[model samples]
Target: MKPLLRVVLVIDALLLLAFGLLFLLTPWTSLYNALQLAQVEPALVGQGFGIALLGLAWLALHASIDGAMTRAVARTVGHVNWLTGVLMLVWLIALRSPSLSAFGQLVGAVVAVVLVLIGLGGVRLAAAVRRREKAQAAGAGATGREQKQAEKAEKQAAQAREAEVYQTEPVTKVSPPVSPATGRRVEPDFTAAHQPGVVTAETRTVETRSTQTHTAADEARDAAADSPGAPRPPFHG
Candidate 1:
C-alpha cells in the first residue's frame, strides 16, 4: 500500500483509540457531564464498548503496518465506520434518544462526519491495494508464460543444431576380372600364374635326350671292365 493510504489507516487508528479511552473513562471522569455523552446504564457496558473500540483500533493500526491484513482489515473497518456513523445520525436526529444531550447531538454529527471521511479514505486505500495485487499477479503469470515459451524455443533450436544429416550414394553391380588386351573374362589360375611360360613339346624332348646320354655312358663302362679281365688286374688275381 502507498504511504498516503497507510497514513489514512493511522488516522483511523488514532480516532478509534481516542474514543475507546474516552468511553473507558466515562465512569470515572467528567466526560459524560462535560460533553453530555450517552449515559451508559452500567459502568461495565461502557467499558465493554471501550474494549471493543480498542480492539478495532489495534486492528487498524496493525493493518497499516502489515501487508497481509491491510486490504481485508481496512475494508472491514471502512464498512463498520460508515455504518456506525449512519446509526448515530439516525439515533440523534430521527429517534432523538433521551439519553443523548443537545450538545452530544453536535458532537455526534462532527464525529459522524469524521468517521465517514475516514471510512472513505480506508475504502479507497483497500481498493487500490487490491488492484495493485491483481496487476502484480497478472504480470507474474505473463512473465512465467513468456519465460517458458523462450525456453521451449531455445530447446527446439538446440535440437535442430545438434541433429545429424546423412548423405546416400548410388551403388553399381560389380563385374568379373577381365584382361585389358584379350577381350575376355579371365578366370583365375593360381598354378600357372607362378610359372614363367606354358609347358610345350620342347620340354619333353629335353628329358628324352638326357636319358639316352646316361644309357650310352653305362654301356662304355661295362666294356672296359670286360677288357680289364683279359689284361689281368691285380685285384683279380
Candidate 2:
C-alpha cells in the first residue's frame, strides 16, 4: 500500500510539473496554444500561478521519496486533486471557458478523470495502511494474552503439586517433653502412691544411709541393759 501510494505521488508530481512548465513558458512561447489552455491576462499572473504549481510538484515528489511524509501529503494532495478535477469539469462542460475546440475539451476531460482517480487512490491507500497497522496491534495483544495464560497455568500446576504433597504426607506422633538441663527424658507425674519420681543412683544412696542409723541405735540400748550399766526403777507399787 505504501509503495502504491508513493507511485501515486510520483504521478501527481509529473502532471503538476508539466502544467507548471507550460504556464511558465507562456510569456515567451505559443506553447499554451498547443494545449488550448486559456492564457491568463498579465503574463506575470500566469507566471505566479506557474510558480505555485511548481512548488506543489516539488512537494509531491519529495513526499514520494521520504517514506514518513507520504501518508499526510497523499491525503492532502488527494483531496485537493479531486476537487480541482471537479471544478475543471464544471468549467469545461458548464461554463465552456477558454472557447477551445472539441479535441481540447476532450483532453481536459481526460485529465480531470485522471486527477479524480489518482486522488481516490491516495485516499484508499492511506485507509489500507491504517487497517494494516490496526491488525498488527491486535495480533500483538493476542500474543500477550496467550503468554499470560501459559504463565498462569504453570503457577497453578505448582500450587496443585504443593497441595497434593500436603494431603498425602504421613502424620508425625507426639512425644513427651524432655528436660533441657539434665538431658533426661521426663515422664508425666501420676496420682498413685506407688508411682515413683525419676529414680536415679542418688535417691538409692540416701535411703540406705537412713536404714543403717536406725539399726545401730537398737543394738546400743540392748547391750547397756545386759551389762547393768543402765539406770533402773527403785520401787514399784
Candidate 3:
C-alpha cells in the first residue's frame, strides 16, 4: 500500500475508535439527545452500540487490506459500509421529527451521497491498481521471452558462423608418383637400345673366359707333344 493510503486507513481507524469510545463514554441522556430520541429506551442505546461496533468492524477490515482480496469484494464491502452509514444518518435525521423536516434530511442526504461517492471512488482506485499490476506482469513476461529468443538466435548465429568458417578453409593433398621400370624406384637405361650388342659388360666377361680356356688347351697340347703318350695339335686358320 502507498504511504498516503496507509495514512488514510490509519485516520479512518482512529475515527472509528473515537466514535466507539464516545458512544460508550456518553451518558444515556446525551445519547438520546444526539439521536433526538424522546423515549430514551434501552433499545435505542442498544442500536447505538450496534452502530459503533459496525464502525469498529469496518476499521478492522480496512486495516487488514492485502493483495489477495478481489477488487470486486472490496468495492462491494465499501459500498455496503457507505450505505449503512447513510442509513444511520437517516435514522438520526428521522428521529429529529421537525415540522418542516427538510433541512436535517437534506444534510443527511448530502453526507450519504458524499460517503457513497468516496466508496465508489475507492473501488475504481482498486480496479486501477489491479490493472496496472496485470500490465506490469505482462510486460515483464514479454521481456523475458524476448530475451530468451535473442540469446538463442545469438548462439545459433555463432554456430553458423563457425561452420561457415570451417567450410571455407583450404585443404591439402599429397601422393607418390609411379615408375614404369619394375614399377618401382629403378632408373631406366635408354642407351641399351641403341648399342644392342657392342661388347656389353656381360658379353665381354664371357669372351674373356673362353679365350683363357683356349690358351690353356694349347699349352697342354705342347706339353703332351714332348711326352711319351700325348695328343697332337691340329693346324687351323
Candidate 4:
C-alpha cells in the first residue's frame, strides 16, 4: 500500500474512534425528553442504559473495521450503523409529540443531526477504501497482462533468430560444369579418366572445332581445282 493511502486510512480510523467516544459519553437527555414530550429525569436514567448500548455497538463496529474483532463480532457490528440511524429517527419522531417542551425538542433535533453526520462520514470513508482497493487490483491485473505479452513476443523473436541462423550456414551439394560442345552439364572426374595423350573435356571441344574447320577448307580447295576454265590462282590471292 502507498504511504499516503495508509495515512488516510489511519486518519479516518482515528476520526471514527473519536466519534465513537463522543457518542458513548454524550448524555441521553435528548432522547429521553423527546420520548416523554417533557423533561423527565427518571426516563432519562432508564434510556441512558439503551444509549450506552448504542455506544458499545459503535465501538464494536469500529473494532471490526480494524480487524480487532472475531468474525461474529464483525457481523454484528455490520448492523450497528443501521440500528443507530433508526434509533435516532425514532427519538426525533417522539419529539414531535405535543407534550414535549420546545427546549427538549430542539435538543433532540441537534443530537439526531450530529449522529447522522457522524455515521455518514464513516460510511463515506468505508466506500472510499473499497474504491481504492478495487482500482489497485485492476491496475495490477493490467500490468500482469502486459508482462505476459512481452514475454511471449520475446520468445517468438528468439525462435525467428534461430531459424535465420540455420538457413545461411553451408551444406553439402553436387556441382557440375557445363560441356560447351554438347551443351550439357557433366560431373566427370578428370583425374580418374586419365589416358596417355588424352585431352580434357575443355581441350577436346577446341580441337574438334579446329579439325572441322580445316576439313571444310580442304573441300573448297578441291572444288576450285576441279573447275577446268579457272586460271591458276595466285598464291597470295
**CA deviation > 4 Å runs, candidate 3:** 1-8, 18-29, 32-77, 85-111, 171-237
Clash list (residue pairs), candidate 2: none
Residue-wise C-alpha lDDT for candidate 1, range 66-136, written one tens digit per residue = 87887888889888887888877788778887556667778888888778878977898889989999999
- Residue 197 of model 4 has an lDDT of 80
Comparing 3 with 4 on TM-score, the higher-scoring candidate is: 3
Best of the two (1, 4) by TM-score: 1
Q: Is candidate 3 or candidate 4 better by lDDT?
A: 3
TM-score of each: 0.66, 0.62, 0.49, 0.44
What order do you get sorting by TM-score, best first? Answer: 1, 2, 3, 4
Residues 131-164 of candidate 2: C-alpha lDDT, one tens digit per residue: 8878999999999999999999999999999999
User: Candidate 2, after superposition: displacement of residue 138 in Å?
Assistant: 2.3
Supply every candidate's count of residue pairs whose N, Cα or C atoms clash at under 3 angstroms.
0, 0, 0, 2
Off-target runs (Cα >4 Å) in candidate 1 are 99-102, 164-237
Model 3: per-residue lDDT, tens digit, 1-237?
333333434444454564555455445666645554343245558558757655754654564474354344455545654775667566656655442245545655665665565556555655666787789999999999999999999999999999999999998754444554367753445676336565577667777988998999999978878997776568787
Question: Between the candidate structures 1 and 4, which one is better when assessed by lDDT?
Answer: 1
Which residue runs of candidate 4 sit more than 4 Å off their true CA positions?
1-79, 94-104, 173-237
Which prediction has the highest lDDT against the true structure? 2
Q: Largest TM-score belongs to which candidate?
A: 1
